[model samples]
Target: MGIKSFQGKRDTSQTNKAEEQILVSDYMTTKLITFKAEDSLDDVIALLIKHHISGGPVVNDKNELIGIISETDCIKHISESKYYNMPSDINNTVGNNMVTDVDTIDKNMNIFDAAFKFLASRRRRFPVVDEHGVLLGQLSQKDVLKAALKVKGNTW
Candidate 1:
């Protein structure tokens, strides 16, 4: 009977964590400073510096989430341009060089799942979007960690 009670308590603890209902929308940053695919690399660099972010999401004309641009990507582009004797202004558009294979999150996803995604990938942040892929907000690993810390634990 003691073993049965202990098992039940363990199951209940795991259930609480799995059933936590904190969604991405609850904590995502809504005031996102987004960028356009047509934005030049110099412009993106300036914006990133101004916003104090390592990267920003690339949106379409309709403000739909498409891709992401990171500082690493920019640095690589600049280095390659210099090494290959290519004009930085030429072929240096975000749309041409930005990472199109972006991993995104839906606003309705739970915080636990978001945490898992962060663990499985090295991405610093994710673009949160609507069903139609519209830019809704941004979710960082720190945001996920913050949400995780809010879940009711066995201790408190």
Candidate 2:
């Protein structure tokens, strides 16, 4: 006689459910602090401090992303002004100091892939954009950590 099998068949449905992709949009922060290119650095600094944020996206009048401004950039501008003996608070604009070559992530991108991108780029946050490159939201390293924790039992 053939050997009897006591264990039931494995549940493939559960396996499939565990593999569901988690997109960046689900975890990204929709409420963002944005700046304009013409915005004064002094004002930007004040807002950054008031909101306790390290940086923010710079946009145009049409609300399109043009660049990114960070505390590092502000410090750089201050240092340069000091070296030149110029007034740091005068004529400094976000457009002049913001990083134009900004790297963005797709809203539909998988969370794991976004995490990999964060690791590769060494960026604390990534701006999530749409097909037209409109500013939608921002995915931060903390968001990725939260995702990991949520899916730990299923995916990890």
Candidate 3:
């Protein structure tokens, strides 16, 4: 019998379920925080602070995933930039150093792959991309954690 069929045999479908049926798209956050490559660091920071988000997807004008920007990126820049040499328009430029190369996944990628990527990267979330690598949404650690808890039959 198939896994879903086996799941149907369970007494309580609400709990004791396996993760095989789950995909990143099933739980990924569709409401994404995104920025263009040309957007300023100051602007990105304000968005992050306002939304209380740790990171955002960096996209091209075509809405393709170019990279990601995180609180770490901002902090690293702030700590490393020398005050004496700092440009007056530092807030207007989103420096190359502030963006992280995107490690993206497709909407159909299995949950295991998403979980593995999260475990491997320094990022707690991944930008989901389309077949052509366009930004679609994001899968966060929170989503993965929730799935894990559900599999383990635990309540939040």
Residues 1-156, candidate 2: write the lDDT tens digits: 999888888778778867788999999999999999888898999999999999999987766788999999998987888678997564599988999999999998999999999989999999988887789999999999999888857565
Report lDDT per candidate: 0.84, 0.90, 0.74
lDDT assessment of candidate 2: 0.90
The segments of candidate 3 whose C-alpha lies over 4 angstroms from its true place after superposition are: 1-20, 90-92, 152-156
The order by descending lDDT is 2, 1, 3
- Per-model TM-score, in order, reads 0.81, 0.91, 0.74
> What lDDT tens digits, residue by residue, belong to model 1 across residues 45-150?
8988988999988998898988999898888898889678987775798888899898899898987778888889977788998888999999998897787687
Q: Please report the candidate that would top lDDT against the real structure.
A: 2
lDDT of 2 at 122: 97
Tally clashing residue pairs in candidate 3. 0
lDDT of 1: 0.84
Higher-TM-score candidate of 1 and 2? 2
RMSD of each: 4.2, 1.9, 6.6
Q: Which regions in candidate 1 have their CA more than 4 angstroms from the true location?
A: 1-20, 83-85
